[model samples]
Target: MEQFIQDWGYIALFLYSFGGGFLALAIAGAFSYAGDLNIYITVIVAGVSNFIGSQFLFYFAKYNKSYMDETVNKHRRKVAMVKTMLKKYGSFMIFIQKYIYGVKTLVPLVMGISAYNPFKYTVLNAIASAIWAIVIGYISFTAGKLLLSFADDFKYVGFFTVLLVLGILVYSFKDKKKVKKQ
Candidate 1:
């Protein structure tokens, strides 16, 4: 991973973040925290990648509206709810779509297919991407830093903690079963 990042630089970061989603962005952040990459550059690349990928999906949905409509029609309630939200919120929906689970791809595509202004979508998406990148990147970087700090100690402590939890769970299950049998 380090080697790939080192060799490919920002291009690799862009590609990875494009398809890899949040997990990929987090990994990039971890690398940045580890001093293998630059955090600011990583965040920018991640934001751009997310924006491009989302736009691609939006265009695809826009171009294939008929087929998408067929699929969307299968879930009328969900589609209606999302449409209502988009109608009420407009560009704000696009800005915060990335933060909402299950709607990241759908919202953008829906907006595009609905002919919601492309300029607004683009502007809001760009802003959202930057915010997402900054927030997620910082979280992953801090997590990575903490994990590295506790690397050696966590190995032993984590192992025992897992064992202790497992033991308690097993004991509780057995006690319940024994009571039921009695």
Candidate 2:
């Protein structure tokens, strides 16, 4: 498992961060604390992948008018809500979107549809992604160090600590979605 994390962990982190982020990055941070990964490299990989993922969605919506239009029609309320948030907050929405569960990709795509400047989005997204990676990575790394200290005293205990943190994060996010829907 350590070898796998050392080998393909960053790759998995890249893909997971590109898709949804939050949970996977947090896990990587904990792993880094446990010495299974390098936090610096993990943050770098996550930041770059996150930047590319948002860029791809933004450009796809910007250039692919037909598809975006179809998507907008189908998910009109959600898209409209994002558009409203963009208007209300302006480019600040880019930074804020990374933390929001449902709207991370939606914000970028909506920005594209609204004809936001590509270069500006890229610059802002780069900064925001870096910040997101640093913040999330550090927090989880710290949590792992504290919660996983028990593992240092008794090896197997630390592994379960990591798992417990992961399960809690997953459950909390899922619970938030349910509450928001209700």
Clashes of each: 0, 0
Model 1 stretches astray by more than 4 angstroms: 8-13, 149-182
Residue 67 CA error for candidate 1 (Å)? 1.8
Which stretch of 10 consecutive residues in model 2 shows the poorest summed lDDT?
145-154
What's the C-alpha lDDT at position 116 in model 2? 81
Structural similarity to truth (TM-score) of each candidate? 0.72, 0.80
Task: Estimate candidate 2's RMSD in Å.
Answer: 8.9
In the range 51-165, model 1's lDDT, one tens digit per residue, is: 8988887778889999998988887787787888888987788777777766776787788788677787778778888888999989988887775567656789989999999
* Reference-based lDDT, each prediction: 0.80, 0.88
User: How do the residues 51-168 of candidate 2 rate in per-residue lDDT, one tens digit apiece?
Assistant: 8899999899899989988888988888888888988999999999999999997998888887688999999999999999999989988898775665468777767888999999
* Model 2 global lDDT (CA atoms, 0 to 1): 0.88
Model 2, 60: alpha-carbon shift in Å? 0.8
Error of 1 at 85 (Å): 2.3
